[model samples]
Target: MEAINISYRAMIILYALITVPVLICFFLKLGNVKQILIAVLRMTVQLAAMGLYLDFLFRFNNVWVNFGWVILMIAIANITVNRNSGLRTARMFLTVMLGLTISAFFVIVIFIFIAIRPEPFYDARYLIPISGMVIGNCMRANTIALERFYASIKKNEREFLTYLLMGATLREAALPYIRESVKSALAPHLATLATLGLVSLPGMMTGQILGGSTPIVAIKYQIGIMIAIFTAITVTTVLNLLLSLKVAFNEYSILKRDIFRN
Candidate 1:
């Protein structure tokens, strides 16, 4: 069975639904109606551009090209994580990128090469989408972990120094903050996992179903992607924190104030 396509007029009609939220925001004096409209416009333009680019990419599907695209995605994700986490990009970019690359590629190798094993293992369709999913999740997780960890230490400098003064090693002193940050980073994903199908259909599964795949096939893909996302996030969060420790702190175990943007 082929998937049904929405026509341009249908899409325009769908976009018209934004008025509902815009009206509600205006009524509530939210003052974000402009922001909402701008966001919608940006999303529309970005997706349209991506759609064109992806069409070209799919047609020109070379292994090197696909691999290069994945690298680009990783680099973009790294920059975004640094900016959002309030970390100085110069200090943490390479370290965080390394962690992200390791985690994303590790899971991609298993998921794309071992599990899915599409006709051309490096098919752009599978490789690009899966890598984006993994890298995107890693970006968000690392942002939360880094922000929470550094913010916690900065806020509780006395407590952290007290731990150090009480004969704790640098790693020991930072252990509590590390645990807290990692937990905070993973909590949302864990909750989503726990309530996945019961709460609502996930994007991957829903997209596959809409694209005419059998329910079982969609479910299998969803399961694989979820596991891949979770593994990637966990590894990236922990690895980024640990690797960043080398540059985030001084030899005397002090977090460099310069590492923060603000």
Candidate 2:
């Protein structure tokens, strides 16, 4: 069965719903209506372009092409993570790129080959979406982990130095920061995992159901995807931090002031 398509007129009506918030912002002097409208327009344009590319991906469905796309995605996510983490991209680029690529590729290979096992094994429909979900979550986790971690160390230079001066190795001294970063980065995901079915209807399951998949099937797929997402985020966050340690610190174990960009 085919999912019902939203008409252009229906989309216009849906877009009209934003007018309420825009007007509210306008009256309250929130000064973001222009930004809001621009963001909405950008979202429309971006999604339209993505839809076009996705159509091509589905049509071609070549194994190498699919993997090349995933690699491109990994590169983009790496760049985005570093850019938003307030870290100088040049300093941490290779570490972030390699860390995320390894984690994402490892998880996706296991997930698709051992778990999902779609036809042809490299089906774009399966590989692309799953890779996106994994890479996207990993990106967010890395951003939070890196930003919180470096900011914490930078703010606690005295304590970090004290740890170092008191006979702690660089690894030992960074342990506390690493623990804090990993915990904080994964916290929201832990909460979401706990509250998932009872409090939330996940998008994957909802979309599957809307696409005429059985509720049971949708739930099963959602469970697999959630596990993959959780694993990918956790592994990528830790790997990024560990791999970045060498680049982020000096020979004296000092956190480099130049690593972070204001």
Candidate 3:
């Protein structure tokens, strides 16, 4: 039941497989051949570098190193969420990080630590990947929520202002947009969760199976991770948007124009 290693030659063949799409893009004048190649090259370089560092980290397996790496990932994710969501980076950085940290506490402490309890508790192989999954999904959800919330209020400023003028509190006026953004951010994850096994074998389950876990065991882990991801994304997105109301608005409840980078 041991997994077979992929040889370097197999990797080279995989890289070569991209040539078909590269040629098609070239002939179609897609003008994205360079972009495609750059993306692939970046993916290759990043994963390769990560592979080396992960090997080092795994070998050493210090508790501090593992937790520090998770913190770094969250910090990076926080910044990206701020920048992409059009929230002023300096203004939203600490707020975003706090939201992310809180969400991480829920996922890692409750699910990973209490439920799974992988040996050594700080095992990088388990902690790092699970942290990455939780943090990464939270980043995406936060970006969507913030962007939609702010953009909606900005685009419908008159409507928002009218709501406030009608004696509605700031929270009441903002509730509509907040609900919309949360719904928008959560829709895809919901659909994916619904169709998980029916549509396709989830990547984590597939990887675990390939790594020689029994199919039933892999499914259990997959279910746990999916629940972790969905919950993390929901809590992070809602918390971020709620906190953002303070950071993104003026005392009079106006969306700050200067907060957007673009």
Candidate 4:
């Protein structure tokens, strides 16, 4: 299949259009123009670099290089999740990484190896991109779950302790916060699924269609991907919060301030 190509002039024009939001923000005094501009610039640079690297990866098709690239993505995602969730990297990095890697790997492998079964099983074309998508979403969900779970526990420390004092087990005491955090983390995915066909065309399905797949085939792929994403999120969020309890609290079952980013 021939890949679509965009010329340099077209890319420049596309980049120029990004400033419309920045300009509007400046006039509206939203005070985020600088941040918006910087974010756009960073996104452009990062995506450009990733595209180039992916092109090379596809060309080489080396198993080791592909595996290493996936690992690198997981590592970068680990740091990003911790940093964004306002957790101290030194404390939660490994835990977050483990939660994400385990769940994402499980879902991706099952889908690629058992379900999809793209030839060669470890085909970079299928394995890397699908894993990247699942892992990226899992990282985000776990970060939110961990952050909110710990934050809620700390915010309601008195209530949490009261439950423990009242003879509730640690799991029982943490259940409320865990429920809330899990709901909060999963809400976006639920909402997306609800409005999926009406509000917007999903990127993955659209890409498949554009890449020469039939609409029915694209829909099937979309369904499979969504199932994988949902499974990954559910497993990672629960496991992440469950695992986080070990490090997030002291012997007294009290949250430790040292675990936060501040």
Model 2, span 1-262: residue lDDT tens: 8699999999999999999999999999999999999999999999999999999999999999999999999989988998999999999999999899999988898889788899989999999998999999999999999999999999999999999999999989999999999999999999989999889879899999999999999999899989999999899998999999999999999988899887
Report the candidate with higher TM-score, 1 versus 4.
1
lDDT of 3 by residue, 1-262 (tens): 8789989999899999999999999999999999999999999999999999899989999999999999999999988988888777888888888899999879999777899898999998899888998899999998899889988999999999999999988889999998999999999899999999999669999999999999999999899999999999899888888887788889999888888887
Candidate 3's C-alpha runs over 4 A off are: none
Q: Per-prediction TM-score, please?
A: 0.97, 0.97, 0.96, 0.93
* Two-way lDDT contest, 2 vs 3, winner: 2
Q: Name the TM-score of candidate 2.
A: 0.97
After TM-score superposition, the amount by which residue 33's alpha carbon in candidate 2 deviates from its true location, in angstroms, is: 0.6
lDDT for every model? 0.94, 0.93, 0.90, 0.86
What is the C-alpha lDDT profile of model 1 across 1-262, one tens digit per residue? 7779899999999999999999999999999999999999999899999898789789999999999999999999999999999999999999998999999999999999999999899999999888998999999999999999999999999999999999998889999999999999999999989999999669999999889999999999999999999999999998999999899899999889999999
Best by lDDT: 1
Q: Report the CA-based lDDT of candidate 4 relative to the real structure.
A: 0.86
Off by over 4 Å in 2: none
**Per-candidate RMSD, Å:** 1.0, 1.0, 1.2, 1.7
